[model samples]
Target: MSITKSYSRPLDFKNGRIEMSYGAGGRAMAQLITDLFAAAFDNPYLAQGNDGALLPMATGRLVMSTDSHVVSPLFFAGGDIGCLSVHGTINDVAMMGAQPLYLSAAFILEEGFRFADLKRIVDSMAKAAFDAGVPIVTGDTKVVEQGKGDGVFITTTAVGVVRDGITLSGDRAQPGDKILLSGTIGDHGMAVLSQREGLSFDAPIVSDTAALHALVAAMLDCGASLRVLRDPTRGGLATTLNEIAKQSGVGMLLNESSIPINQPVEAACEFLGLDPLYVANEGKLVAICAAEDAERLLDVMRAHPQAKEAAMIGEVREDAHGFVQMTTKMGGRRIVDWLAGEQLPRIC
Candidate 1:
């Protein structure tokens, strides 16, 4: 019997640095893909080794979402850019009351980037996808010249299937609806900012980055009375609510005291002269439902570990301008307008 020759040697992950040729679409690139990405994100669909996946779909409406991660200091207290990329896309898909099925990732790597770091990131991404039961079915990678790009940038696209008779949208909120929040806010933005600015607090504020599809599934079990669902991310709760207000053509009235915030996150925002309302949250979500179904939804949300602190923070109201108002603890009413500019840039 004749022995076949191997196309590539063992990768020197400990000491090897990424080279330009790795992205040149040759044996080197093939070796990287096979040895690293494919090995980490192993699944039946990905095992096909095709340019794209041929997915098997159930009877449902398809939902798709895409997101990019350029967060500074790729690694932070609780998570890194890798898991953030996966969780962000998963949350986006879950926001529409869909069951996420698969994911695709593309990486833009900088020349001279350490192979070990790249491996670490890929490992985290794989673990997140595996835990969420969502496989990464296809991917691509490229290297940019040194100084031309960040150490790494990741873009992810997710596809899901929504069951028949389930329709969720930003334009669905109506007057007299109740607004529910999953948990404390501002953890993600403050965590990344602290790492980037090298600021220390009384307690380490870790990012709340996590895949929220399971929690969403639990909420959907309560019934399909859910009108709007959103994961307050980049521009924070304020921006997300503003977008929903405009989309639904309704106004919102929030209770300032009802909104949850961690003590350390609150202190960090105060020290940084930031508003917790405008800070980002990775694992949390905003749910809107009819007045009668509010209690049932809250019960479902509170039962989940990720939403133990869930609260009914606001309600939808009729208004011509679609204003978002907050009732302060001091009994004063203030308009929670849209964020004037980027509150914290490069945040997921």
Candidate 2:
């Protein structure tokens, strides 16, 4: 008699969760992949049943990126591991001004992982990849001891085709350029925190985890003269901006009032003693363009659904100290300095 067969149907995945046998290299493991992960992320690359995906590519410089998703509480308000993994890898490639074409995912499961939950994550991943117009080609599966691994962890590798004359990098930002933010900050982190800790709000918050290539392409199409493009992931907008400022050896001065922040998110941060600047965001981006092209660029961003809240919040300038300063809403200037301590680690 099959031990699993004795269990109840419909799988009480909400509570009855992961186990070691799920990750073990055996019949159960194969069944789990075939029925769940593979089903959700299926494509010719992943369908090949191989160790790695073999793919053809264009001649231009290829953009490749890899990222791992291991957010606590695998499922959260408005998003989960499945779509997050796809968005993470795709955004990494998009940061390079590349058109992401394909993805490969690897899953690490603790022994007792629940089949029903796995199915949900895989389905979510597939929908994201498919909707983003990128297919996951190949992948790997591994099992860890019951206690050694989290419920599940996913790592994804993406390959993209970079358009000619669209080179962008953190080091490419320059003084006198206009700094534009894609949209409001801190929503993703707030949403995740609220869901994990059972907090509720009058206005529900949702993680902004999403793919950014389409938005980037739209901006590029406008010929707004982009010098640099970056997605604010871990450490949020503050960290990413600091990295660019330091890399470009310049300073950033901002009109804080111009930056957008959801009122609910701002309120939550005040309650939690968190700064909205350093909080994590998966769907937001920072763009540095010529000062003359700022308005056109903002227009391009606002035209998109994801960037309806976008705004030009700051300007890069020459500074010996390489400091990032912002004018507060109350008309006081303060250093929007780099985060001294990790806020919300494992945020991405």
Candidate 3:
């Protein structure tokens, strides 16, 4: 399983730009795959060099999820699109209470994109996969003409395994269930927004993008009666809660003061006339469990580094209307509705 090396000069990464020939299925494409993608995402499955990866069969139920990342600013304060693609798909699989195993990535590169930038993104993806103990076992690359595409768009697919007797789903939520939030919200959306709009704050806001399988494993091992797990992503906590509420045919009551948000992000949302609840988040998750096991799950969640700021934010209630309501700090109640439209486009 070896790639044929070219005898000609190596790629001019510093000054060269992607050309159409790179995706023409010729020697240039082979060399690009060998020198760049395969080298960084080196693994036995990928090294096999077949049309598709040969994966081992698992005994448990399998879960698969795919995500496409098109964040406007490819590179931001804490992360770029490369790592974001990996983390986003991994989190999706983990939300099903499964152990992630492998990933497949496909990249659409603009013809004039810089080689140096592509290399940086590929390396970031490699590091993220390595740190998460998952491998990019298969992938495809294509180049689009200039002006036909953004700098790059990455689509990643993840597969995971879940043992028997451990089931989680949005419809599993029931009355008297406690809702828990992993940590602070709006960091990712605000980070991207600040960079795109050239707005600076007293303290820099960085995207909270990270793999959360480890944090999920801790909660599962604690023997808590968990019923639902969801990462509040594009629609933020408000929209995500509404989704779960509709799925389970129930309602939610949240305590405004209980939800955690970074001070800088709060300020940015205020100045920009945006509600943090509808803002996107890439690294935060929401969990629901029986009211009796709420404290136990919260203890284990707080013990994990990814969820140190975890808090019990709300509770599920029996309501045929399937509404999500919140209690503000001023002792007023209001409905937490779904996002009306695109609050921030391409924020991921």
Model 3 per-residue lDDT at 127: 98
Candidate 2: residue 262 Cα off by (Å): 0.7
lDDT assessment of candidate 1 = 0.93
Clashes (candidate 3): 0
Q: Give the CA lDDT, 0 to 100, for residue 184 in model 3.
A: 97
Per-prediction TM-score to the true structure, in the order listed: 0.97, 0.92, 0.97
Q: Write the per-residue lDDT of candidate 2 for residues 56-114, one digit (tens) a residue.
A: 85767899999998887788777898899999999999989899999988898886777
CA displacement after TM-score superposition, residue 181 of candidate 2 (Å): 0.7
Off by over 4 Å in 2: 1-18, 198-203
lDDT for model 2, on a 0 to 1 scale?
0.86
lDDT of each: 0.93, 0.86, 0.94
Candidate 2 vs candidate 3, lDDT winner: 3
lDDT of 1 by residue, 1-348 (tens): 999976567888999999999899998999999999999999999999888888886678889999989888889889999999999999999999999999999999999999999999999999999999999999999999999888899999999999987889999999999999999999999998888755545458999999999999999987849999999998899999999999999999999999999999999999889999999899999999999999999999999999999999999999889999999999999999899988877878
- For 246-270, candidate 3 gives per-residue lDDT tens digits of 9999999999999999999999999
Best by lDDT: 3
> What is candidate 3's CA lDDT for residue 187?
96
